[model samples]
Target: MDDQTDSPDDYHAICLGTAARARGIATRYVDGVYSRFHPFPSRWLALAAGGREYLFASGMLLLKGSDPWRGLGLHINEEATLLIRDKQRAKDFLDARGFGTPAGRVFRRGDLSAALDAFSSFAGPVCVKPNQGTKGELVFPAIADRARYESAVRRVAARHQKILVEESVSGQLIRFFFVRPRVVAVKLSRPASVVGDGSATIANLIEAKNALRDRRAVPGHSNIVVDEDLRDFLAMTGRSLDDVPAAAERVFLRGTSNGATGADSLGCRADLHPSYLDVLAAACNAVPGLNLTAVDVMIRDPAAPARHGNYWILEMNRNPGLTPYHFPWRGEAQDVSGAILDAMERGFAPVPASPPASVPASTHSMPAN
Candidate 1:
């Protein structure tokens, strides 16, 4: 795993496998193959065979022994998973509960006119994305006019029946990897960018950067793509591939900060404000049976104390990719997989006669969905 030779899915599996081995739990990939297409395995399975048999798939765990295992793994039920998948519904739920989430609306493909109307009502630029999208695909951000809004909606509608139009928040994207009762890791996502040299053209800098990425072969890091989108993004800034930027100037290559789309993932757990941690814990606890999740947030400054309007909860992920935390390009790697397994093992332990007094009261309650 340290060599970073495996894909994100393989890395996650390897991390779990390694942790399981240390716990004397036997494990193996069900198909003996790793999926290159998904952050998690589509078919990979981990089986712990000893006095008890445990099966793990895409963060779900099944225990088999004298007692039958419940369908939920890490206390994450199907209902909660489905709720989080529906971006609009999840945001509505959080908003109604006084959680800090962006105001947004959803429209079906046939309701393009309604979406446009809603976009106009927004005071600032809005983002158009699929209601059930992931990995930032089909997500168009920072649209300030009707033309871009309509085009973005139509483009998203081509792939999804429903689109989510929300006011775009200006900030850095941060991911908080939460396992019951705590955030195990935090990552800052930055779009693919290059610091300019005194004389090199933007095109040459991009080429060199891609070459470096190839040489380093950092798992889950994608090569900066040179495409129409990149060209358009540069054009918006009155520059082109041929332009030479002054030395030390950094030029971003993409607007979407997604790992699959050439974003740089940096582990920043140590730099996260304690207030944000409190907010994250409270947010995760608000959703019933949401034991393991990745909460994406937009914050102007992570070091600043979290306030009502300073940060917005983007969405929660049921199965977040662990590769970013394990192999961040700029900071210390975190053991998110290990924390997940720790939670699983804790689930199997016998309940104590009395709950620990030091444990916070919030941790004991699960809000009804």
Candidate 2:
């Protein structure tokens, strides 16, 4: 056997298994890469959790839990989430069901002319990403010009056959985790940024920030990278790596608000409006059997009440991970896995109390060009 087990995927699995054990649920790490787990064998991997047998695969725990989604009749299985892996198809499905998303077009590989043409008339800032993407990989947020949009397309198209070019939605990347018809937890994610200490250059400041992040043994935290994206972002602001900003000034490093990309998260379940719950439930109902999922929403004004038609449902993540939610950077940890276990065992889990407030700033502005 190999002596090393440092893969992030394994780390995530261990975290999930640990969370399950805390809820008196046994877990076994299945060693298959496929999304579905039934065809292999019943004996290869099995667990008796909360007095129920479950099949585990690719960091997802499955069981014959009661249909917690009211009359939706969703079973706990990976098969129900396959459609969402294809982002464009998922958008089409949700759009057909009346869920509002940013309007944009999809481009195939080697179709630069068509993609640039679409970008020419694109209303405003755009977002470019792969049709089949995960963990915000190769996703360029807030693409404003044709050059950047084309560069983003090339980067994403190198790996994926098709790319999605959508209008950029402004606001906080707020996420709502639903365990079937109920919002279990809410998180506010912001792009990674560093506050200038006034003395250190941007390059040195980034180094210091990354050094601090690297010392931590957390699951989701990654060092803020110094790459072309960061360079371009800084250049747009008439700054460079060697420039030093005044103290208390904040400089954003990335456009995407994914924890894997060094973004900060705050637990904000208490601040969500009651109306947001209705919208979240509606998103779940859009896809039959999508009981347990996470809805990524872009709220223009997060401080205001989340009224219907005031937010955009970015996408519904099929198999949402619990590590980031459990070990947030600056907020009380959420027992998401525990809630799942409770829901499976008793058909319901009491919503956790709102943690201490750690709301992010009300707004984020683009770097001045």
Candidate 3:
């Protein structure tokens, strides 16, 4: 939206459309709202050939077909999306089922006093964010005092009625993009940062970094903004925009690790430890009707084998962005768009009756550490 060459939604649409066309399925944009597909019979179509509809946010819809709709990128359903969108509900569900999640509590508007009281109970730093928010908007992480805690609560409360206050877990933020039976791609993200060049001030370094991002013109990537929040974050570390950082010294510009906010995304699917696969698979399978999702996990060390109380599930994304995997700031690009289409095609195929197998309960546990 900030004069970018292309938005994440636009990039995803292009990738999906191209993949669909390659599969011999006619695809065209209808008023730039959604994709119209041919050879599918659906009442929502303007012509007889219109039977399938695909949107980046909402999943695919099949008109006059055996399956009516596939929510959240043609895999997750509406119920699951709604559940995942509400951070409190989703966290409760996962935490109850032995999935490691941050210990936190939710508060509604006008409950500021109670929220502050609960904040004091935490042993270490905490994260304050909207209960139902995305793209890391209005998320304040690593808050350690009463003053910052109160300010974060009031600020977030102004925009959202519900707020979630959770313990801040220290680890690398990794996103596991799970497509039903397997984890297709993994992304490691870091907060917006700039390395010091000795002579240039922080402000100049940020401008230079933004210029590089602009030149790269990577879809879905955003420039690091020199804003009040960034300035405040620097102030907390006793630094300012005018100060010159020593050469090779890296200064983080933000607390939230979001790609849209200039955070760096790196493809790490191949680097993920094998032990995490089981943990991620069990977590994804825990949610019924949730076939495709992006599971955000905080790990102290991803290279090491996963163990209980070593990681925490931050949240789950229903319609996870595909462009990040395809156009990361660093690392190899993954064909996530093609994988979604393949899953969609498989979903539409006739199902053969199979014996129902018992689902094993999760054995993992998260102790308060």
lDDT of 2 at 89: 75
Candidate no. 3 TM-score: 0.83
Where does candidate 1 clash, by residue pair?
A: none
Q: Ten-residue segment with the worst summed lDDT in candidate 1?
A: 360-369
TM, every model: 0.83, 0.80, 0.83
Candidate order (lDDT): 1, 3, 2
The TM-score between candidate 1 and the true structure equals 0.83
The weakest ten consecutive residues by lDDT in model 3 span 39-48
- Kindly list the per-residue Cα lDDT of model 1 for residues 34-109, writing each as its tens digit: 2232324444445544344554554444443322232212223333666798998988877766667788889998
Q: Tens-digit lDDT track for model 3 on 185-231? A: 78998889999989999999999999999899887789998889898
Candidates' C-alpha lDDT: 0.73, 0.67, 0.73
* Predicted candidate 2 versus true structure: per-residue lDDT over 51-87, tens digit per residue: 6665443335455343453221223634446666677
- What's model 2's TM-score? 0.80
Error of 3 at 49 (Å): 13
Q: How accurate is candidate 1 locally (lDDT)?
A: 0.73
lDDT, candidate 1, at 238: 73
Tell me how candidate 2 scores on lDDT. Answer: 0.67
